[model samples]
Target: MILAIDAGNSRVKWGWHDGADWASIATVPLIEFAASSDHINPFSITHGDPERIVIANVAGEGAHQLLVNWTSIFDAEPLWLHGEAERCGVRSRYDRPEQLGPDRWAALVAARAVHTGPCLVVNAGTATTIDMLSGDGVFLGGAISPGIDLMRFVLHEHTGRLPLQEGSYRDAPRNTLDAIETGCRHAQAGAVERMHRAMGGNPLCIVSGGAARSLLELLRLPSRYIENLVLDGLARIALSERAVTR
Candidate 1:
């Protein structure tokens, strides 16, 4: 079995694969992931005894240390994914490949595997990332901006008037709570539209991450939402690496 973990700024997503298919999936708060004792029990779940573990973590604080400690409990060496020139059927076009975020790289790999033709992968999480992949598999650079929660956080933190607002999952804003929600929604929607236009009109857009559904509801363009894309990408990477070694 392969264990795939995506440790982002806000959440930790995990998936278990048994060589044939993804057997189970779960998510937890980022801060709670390392402290959760339940994860240490290999036989506690259906997919028992993960042979390999892969992780894509963007949080720089105690995240790495915690991940290393947690994986050590299972006597597994967790593979920390990083941006590279080429890996898992996707290549980085950045001048300094190492500078690219692992989250984005993993998304690219997963996007190429699941979708055909040119694609724009929009990850709306702690930080919104828009990445473009060419029809022929070339990875073109995209954009990044403050995500929904970040925007709301900034509004409350930096200003005295704007209250800390919770994200609304609904489509239309009706009241004050909805207004703040809609603001964040439009903020993301506008960016997506701009990127879509810059990429030469329409492309197959794939939205993922915590804020994916909210952004999708606000946007006018056609899109498909896939949760745990980073974990899926990690799974793909593990499988690809195994094939190479064989």
Candidate 2:
């Protein structure tokens, strides 16, 4: 059994894989865990212990230590993944390969494993990252921008009148709230379309993260949504020959 953890900016997601497939997958908001005084291993209650545990953390050192403390009961020390020059059939083209985000690296690895052709990997979370992978398993770099929530947050924080409110998407928004919502959503979709066009090979966009559904209807390209993409990639890395703790 292998436990793979993705400690992202806004949430902590994990999956339990039994060599072949996932036995269980779970997600928890960072705030929920942070606020709780008792840091019990939530998954262990239902799924029991794992023989090996691997993690890809992008939530800074504080969260990293929190996770270390939380998973202390497990027998295996958590194997933290870092972006490498090449791993699991995917080669990095970035000048500073190690500087690439672990979540993005994991996603690209997962994309290469599943798709042979050109791929546009989109992870729409607290911040959105759109990465391009070539047909021959080469990661050709990517773009990063504020995600939907961050867009909305900046508008509210930077401006005096804009309040943090939920509004439905509208093509031609008449109200202020709707306009804000539409503009943010449009920004996300537009970036994706531009990247897809720039990638130039009619790449299969593998969409994941919390805001994936929001962009699905807006995307015009051939896109597939995987709910637990980072987790899947972590599992693949856990089983790979090159998977090592940094």
**Every model's Cα RMSD, please?**
2.6, 2.2
After superposition, which runs of candidate 1 have C-alpha atoms over 4 Å from their true positions? Answer: 34-46, 167-176
Compose the digit string of candidate 2's lDDT tens values, residues 1-246: 898989999998888899899998888898775665544766567667787888999988877877788778788777788889998989999999999998999999898888989999999999999999999999998999999999999999999999899788987899999999999999999999999999897899999999999999899989999988898888898888334542
Residue 81, candidate 1: Cα error in Å is 0.3
Candidate 1 lDDT (Cα, 0 to 1)? 0.82
> How displaced is residue 25 in candidate 1, in Å?
1.0
Please estimate how well model 2 matches the true structure, expressed as its whole-model Cα lDDT. Answer: 0.89
TM, every model: 0.90, 0.95
Clashing pairs in 2: none
lDDT of each: 0.82, 0.89
| Clash tally for model 2 | 0
